[model samples]
Target: MDVLEAIVLVNDMVVDSSSRRNDAWPELDDLSAISSSFYRDTDIAEGYGDSALEMELYRLSIEKTRNLVSSGDLQRQLGFLPSMREIEVLPVIYRDRADFVEKILDSIRSSPKNAGISTELHRQLNGFTQSLNVLPDALQNFALFAFRGFYYQELAHLTSASYMPHSWRSGIIRSQLNRSVSRFADVAIGAGEKVRSKLQAAINDEFGAQVISANFPLIASFVIGQASRRSDLLRTAVEIRDSAKATAFRAWVYEMERRIRNEQDLDKVKQAQDELTTLVRELEVDLGLQRKPTQEMTLTLALPLPLTPSIERTLHVSSPAWVRRVLRRRTHLVFLRELAQESISLPPFVRSYQMLKL
Candidate 1:
């Protein structure tokens, strides 16, 4: 078959496998009940055990291939539109690999006791184990694409609400962006730890203490490096998302300024002013300029009594702390007001340059 035909065949296989897996769940549940019963026969128990193992291997295959098919990067590479269920499943898949490998190994080790299980089934299980033995290499390839997929997913989520007011959308997207970065870092580090622990354990089992001692540090350093690479990818993703947000905000600010300059309606001008005020407050917060509590100030005024010879009186006045905050905000309000009233005209180039500086 040609490449296109092969792609179609693989897609068909994935769909069929996924459907079969879904259909098998109820039967698996029934098997679980049967295996747990007091009257269960030996043959039935053995059959149930083998079925569960086969199901697990089958499920993993389906999930891995489905993840590959659903990957955003793969879709982009192949110039295909993403499916409705296009979601990043690699983190989950990778996270479960350690336990899955352990289970497979345990079954292999105990195979001699299960004399009733067919030779064909044993061969299939061994084949599955051999396939999984190459997982460290597979993970390296899959992880790069998976990280990109996650970044694109988050970027799309953050920028999707174009209908919302720019000020509100900006604040929400920034908050979400921060949270997403934190969450992605945690997941990447956690997955790395799991894989590292599993691989280290497998090496220890195979080679014993002397070999492990010699190679332990090297293995640890490699895992840590992988985790750090994931963090770096996350950083790049954040920068791209942040730059996109800044560009959108600049466009919005320009539009609002244009409206303020040319719109005849007082209400529209006022609306623009209000939106700009919100945007300015958000910017101040983002820039670390609006966090401290306001401070009160005391002023002394000296007055001379009208008829007395050089008689002087002093009056002390104090302003409320909140007044300072209002004054600070008033600076932006005045600029917005000037824009609304057409008292100041900013050239487009200068306006864009100022925004870029922001």
Candidate 2:
């Protein structure tokens, strides 16, 4: 088959998985089987090569080959599934390490213009990924299932490290390690038994039918729910890591929130500020990947709260202290000028019950 045909088939795979309406979930189960079958005899990857349970792998190879090629045609037949691009490519690199490095350097040298732009590119394979996401449905479907196979391989390498055959495989596996490095409160919450139990109990207590919606499936929603708790946990982490004044943390959070809210494309840059500002002098470190954060960092996944809807139904809303602080910050206080508005409690929902002074 021509490269074009191969690309089209990959699109078929991607569309089958990621798109919500696609009736192709079964195909995904098959792709994992395909990956297994492809390596049934390949003993290079240790535990990565057991083919007994790989029914889908056999189906995938047969289906892809039969659909793409005539029964007898063979042009070295060296196509690797896009999802296995990194895995396949890395093995080639390991086999020809010097040649791989030389080619990579040569590519870099040829793309001088890309050097600066690439420096700011946070994700590896970002361009390739963006292009793939916009492909035909068949290719998309293929990719979705294929890449998941790579993840499975990575997971295997981790929990059972003695079987790991190569250091290159360690790259993707490090994400599991990155989980520890991740400062996201949500990650911690999802991984913690106590947090999950609490979150589950809270949802059962409040929604009666689990506040999780279809858009955010149950486990996924729970993961993201912890993200809602970030600001709260961020406060605690910053305090622990930096041992700073509470007001300092508040100021930092305000600045972070503002930067995210106001940032826009360069076209939106109304004025170019001078780079040699007093602020730049104060921040001696550059905002690059090589620069480590000054504060101690740890992944402290936010614990889920048994939040009732009356508390405003959003992240960080459960904390009364936050409400008071937010009011004090006056991110908005337009109504304060009115007599009735001024008379209202800070959050508008603060209890009106009065207490006698001792």
Candidate 3:
């Protein structure tokens, strides 16, 4: 028999053996049994010929096994396989550029702080790198930027709390970040002379290199813009700074308001309010719309207002009681808004107060 026929015969033998066992499914142990039987059968061995055919058979067998497992038939038969919910394995295959980009972003967003890339994401990146030459220029640049961005963000999280007391775990995390940054830089530098020059110009010293590596996404965007002559792709330092500031302001305001709304303790609510007010003032000053005052003070008031509900009531009410509850909440919100507006003098604060209106 030829190689194809021999492989078919082997599969038939395996299936026949499984049927003999009261129609039971084949187990991993069946592989060994089938292998021994194949070697013991002189006719089949002579029919296939040579060590080359043996190797071919081995390779095809492995390929066939993978196909079976991937197709879910073998998976269904094997009770040992983990359930989808218990152990999710994201497929590394990408259908198109959009799918690839979405997967990268989703992985980065869902990854835990300081945990670095997941195995599936790493596999996807490796595949992208291996096929980089065949990929479209736009996709190539995006993939590289995403790879660098993920590591940089991880490094930022690792080093953001450097002021805290160092421990063995922290040291390990820092070491990993350093290695990741260095490896990424080396890869980028090896891409081409132009990339190397850009990276080197930004990196004057070891410390500067670390800083640049940690912010490589911004630099990469600029470099890609220059290379492709696309002004829209360029991200200046000022733009990055403003974007970061806006994001931070929004996040801080949301967190503070969430604390104010959820907090049952009066002291904590007052503290959250004070913190929010200070944040608004700081943001205003940062935007160059206001000057810093020489003296900063926070005023606390003891009011007879009842505690706000932890859960916000919807505006669309069908009952009179719900209407009264909504009106009462609106009154408290208006009082808070007027109080904050009297102290803060910026249109930004007006937006922030509106968020408090819930």
**How many backbone clashes does every candidate have?**
0, 23, 0
Model number with the top TM-score: 1
What does the lDDT read for residue 268 in candidate 2?
A: 23
Superposed by TM-score, candidate 2 places the C-alpha of residue 289 at a distance from the truth, in angstroms, of 42
Q: Candidate 2 lDDT, tens digit per residue, 1-358?
A: 1111111111111221111222323432343354322111122222333322222332332343333223221111212222334333332332332343243233223345645433433132233234444544434333333333343444344444222212222232332232432211222112222222343455567877765321111222222222324323222222222222223333433343344346743332222111112112212222221222233334344436655233222232222344334433442111111111222112111011111111
Off by over 4 Å in 3: 1-128, 161-358
All candidates' TM-scores?
0.20, 0.18, 0.18
TM-score of 2: 0.18
Best by lDDT: 1
Give the alpha-carbon lDDT of every model.
Answer: 0.33, 0.28, 0.32
Pairs of colliding residues, candidate 3 = none
Better candidate number, 1 or 2, judged by lDDT: 1
Write model 1 residue lDDT over 203-269, tens digit each, in one string: 6777866333211221122222223343232222223223433234334444444564465565765
TM-score of model 1 (CA atoms): 0.20
| Regions more than 4 Å wrong, model 1 | 1-58, 69-107, 113-358
Question: Tell me, what's the RMSD of every candidate?
Answer: 24.0, 26.0, 28.1
Per-residue lDDT tens digits for candidate 3, residues 165-189, read 1111122223223343222112211
